[model samples]
Target: MTSLGVIFQPWSPPERLRETAVAAERAGLDELWVWEDCFKESGVTSLVVALTTTERLRVGVGILPMPLRNVAVLAMEAAMIQRLFAGRARFGVGHGVLDWMGQVGARVASPLTLMREYVPALRRLLSGEEVTAAGRYVNLDRVKLDWPPAVPVPVLAAAEGPKTTALVGEVADGLVLTGGWSADMVRDSVTRARAARSAAGVEGAFEVAVFLMTDFGEGAAERMEAEFDRWEFTGERRYAALGSVEEVTATVREVFDAGATSVLLQSRTDSDDIEGFVANAGRVRELLLR
Candidate 1:
């Protein structure tokens, strides 16, 4: 069965996360994702709040900025979360927004190279293996986690372009596609990623997780239109869902049918009713289960 999740956009203040997470679990949603966007709340911190507040509510950090954090630091943090929460945590990493990276002096000239080196090493470290690499970006010296997750934790990477997507397939356990992609685009991306994995002779269960842009309640249609325009989204499909819970649920199903392993609903950042939005998402999850 395809999993359904919701993104707790960083745009909302930190105070709202606990209620939002509790609402998701109370509403029966499968997962709640948090963003580690630059100049925003820390994704790991948010995850702790959400996870500690509710049982059975899996939390995912959609994509941590690879340039800013040392791989060993991430390994330690992720390992602790896994040990504490067991199988309820998910992690993803990527080249953060270039402009933001530049602001913090963490930007690298070659993001693909950084990912190529960082992901595999991070995965190994999580699996309790010592990693020694002398790559262009990642330079590790026989570093291993003192306390690794008891079970393996799959590392996911975010990708928008073909090169990054293919790299994700070659090195990572899962791919996280951002919002504003149509179902057809997701299908094509999955095919491309699978081909890359095959060419690399990598074998295992690879997952494609998508963030489907969504809006609910009053003026949802207008909000969605504005969001699409901001995203410069073009095409007959619009790549976002609005209107009723049933409508958004249908869009989620369409993306799942397009080969997505999971669909995370990305709502507007300035949404007024965080709890209501989560409950609506729970309703959508229930509808999908039926």
Candidate 2:
């Protein structure tokens, strides 16, 4: 069965995080993804809160930027969350978008190199293995986690382009396909990433989690169009904005058929209408699951 999840954009007040998590759980979402995009509160912090509040749903940070923090800090944080959530925490890390990173005066150049070196070091540290490496971007000496996670922490690499996707397949456990991508776009990306994995004989399931937008109401078409317009203005990819419940179902099925082990919908709403979002998601879920 293809697992379906939802992305929680913590753009509202802190109180909204708990409320959204409760609502999403009731709505039958398998996972909840929180993101950090140069925002006020970090995604990991919000994820910790959500994990504390929720009972069964898996909580993940859609991505924490590699350039913004040290690898040691990341490893420590991941371990803490895994232990705190009783092993229900998953961490996704990536070289964030240039525009957003620039806001903090951070440069995210040569992401492939950064991720390639950063991931292994973080993994070794998290697993309590001695880390001794002198690489171009990262250099560590005899560092290991004092307290390792009891359960395996699945680290997903957020990749969009071919180079990054292949790198992710070669290293990380899964791939976090950037939201706003079309089904065809996801298919192409998965094909490339899988080929890389196959060549290396890495046999395991690679997650293809996508972020999407949904709206359910009589004026769904208009709402979807407005959502597309918002993406257009922000220069976000407009492929995930489907016009109707049927369109949303089709798009999701297309990705699933293309080898997405799971799909994560990042519902975008124009109003403070939680009921409307849940209703629209329910309709789309009914059509897709049926």
Candidate 3:
């Protein structure tokens, strides 16, 4: 069964997250995702609040940049949340926006190399194993989490490029597709991920989680069009849902049939009614359930 989710975009004020999270759960949203974009909210901090506040809503922090964090600290934080909330936590990591990384002096010459090494090490630590590795970017010495999750948490890696997608399939437990990819692009990405996993002899259910740029109600068309212009989105992969619940639900199903395990509806960052936007997520979920 494909699941539905909504994002509390980084551009929104962090103070706004709590109310919106409560509203989302109340509104019947399956999962709530938050960003760890540089100079914005701390993914771990915000997600902890979210998990503690909501009894059943699973909280996801999509793509915390490893460059800005120590793997040991990340492992500890993830373990804490998983232990506290059990099945209500999902965390992901990737190369954050490159320019933001550069601004903080955390930029690495090879992000792929960093993630290739970082993810496995983080996983090992979370599985209660001490990790010590010297790679092109990540290095740790005898680091291990004292209280790793009883079962290691499934970690998703953000990917849009083919190589990153393949690397994620080879290493991480899931893939987080960037928004603006068409259903066909989503299918092709799933295939590429599986191919890499199969070639590497890895086996298991690897999930494909994609973000769908969503627009609805008043001002939706102009919002969608402006987004396209801003993202410089062109070609067939500029995927978005721009109309009523029926249209958005159909788009979700199309992506699901094309091979997405979950679809997260992302409203524009400038959207003022964040809670209202999430409240409407229930509409999409309802149509999907039917």
Q: Could you tell me every candidate's TM-score relative to the true structure?
A: 0.97, 0.90, 0.96
Question: What local distance difference test score does each model get?
Answer: 0.89, 0.77, 0.87
Report, for all candidates in order, the number of backbone clashes: 0, 1, 0
lDDT of 3 by residue, 115-226 (tens): 8999999888888998899988878988877788987698899998999999999999999987898999999999999999999999888888889999878678787888
lDDT of 1 by residue, 1-290 (tens): 68998889988989988988988898998999999988889988988888999899889997899999999999999999999998799999999999999999999999999999999999999999989999998889999888889888999999989999998999999999998889899998898889999999999989888998999876788888877787677784467877799888888889999999889998876676778888889899889988
Residue 201 in model 3: lDDT: 98
Candidate 2 Cα RMSD after full superposition onto the native fold (Å): 2.5
The positional error of residue 272 in candidate 1, measured at the CA in angstroms, is: 1.5
Candidate 1 positional error at 282, Å: 1.0
Error of 3 at 36 (Å): 1.0
Model 3 regions lying over 4 Å from their true place? none
Report the backbone clash tally of model 2.
Answer: 1
Q: Please report the TM-score between candidate 1 and the true structure.
A: 0.97
Candidate 2, residue 83: lDDT: 81
Q: What lDDT is reached at residue 224 by model 1?
A: 85
Candidate 2 lDDT over residue span 179-215, tens digit each: 6777777788888988998998888767777766655
